[model samples]
Target: MKKRNQYSAEFKAKVVLEVLREEATVNEIASKYGIHPVMVNRWKQEFVDRASEVFKKGPSEAEKALEKEQQHVAELERKVGQLTYEVDWLKKKSDEILNRKRP
Candidate 1:
């Protein structure tokens, strides 16, 4: 069995950009990169299809999820702080009561 080749995002982008430029045939690009022509074509198609995503305004889904997660963590941290303070107060009061009873 042979392992599959992995191409980086930068390399794929370069190849796709070259294809978009129409400076050479897809076959030529594929041979130069030592990859299959179909692979090159697939990358080109995917790049063209998703190019609009680069221009879209507003936060992406991943960013929104990250923000929501950060808020949740902050809320949890605040609750923990409040609980810790309450526990410390309760312990101090209990110690005072115990000391009073001993006198």
Candidate 2:
């Protein structure tokens, strides 16, 4: 049985970057790296797809800050609900004690 090849993230990134340069053909790059041509082509396409996102301003600093703030609000809301439940329980016990003293 032939052993399957395993590649690290760094190695895949390097291969994708090399292909993005467009200076070398996929076949040539594959030959130099001893990887399959189809694998090199797939990496090249993936790099192209992700490279566009880097240039776009979709995930800006403001968006990240807003996300953090929303998460904090959610946590605070949960705490408030827990405290409210506890207060209601205590109020019910207090009412019961006062009624017993009257009787």
Top TM-score: which candidate number? 1
Clashing pairs in 2: none
lDDT of 1 by residue, 10-32 (tens): 99999999988999999999999
Candidate whose lDDT is highest: 1
Which residues of candidate 2, in runs, are more than 4 Å off? Answer: 52-103
Model 1 off-target regions past 4 Å? 69-103
Q: After superposition, how far is residue 97 of candidate 2 from its true place, in Å?
A: 32
Each candidate structure's TM-score, on Cα atoms with residue i matched to residue i, is 0.65, 0.47
Candidate 2, residues 1-103, lDDT tens digits: the string is 9999998879999998888787898899999999999998887777777776678767777788999999999999999999999999999999999999995
TM-score between model 2 and native: 0.47
Worst lDDT run of 10 residues, candidate 2, spans: 52-61
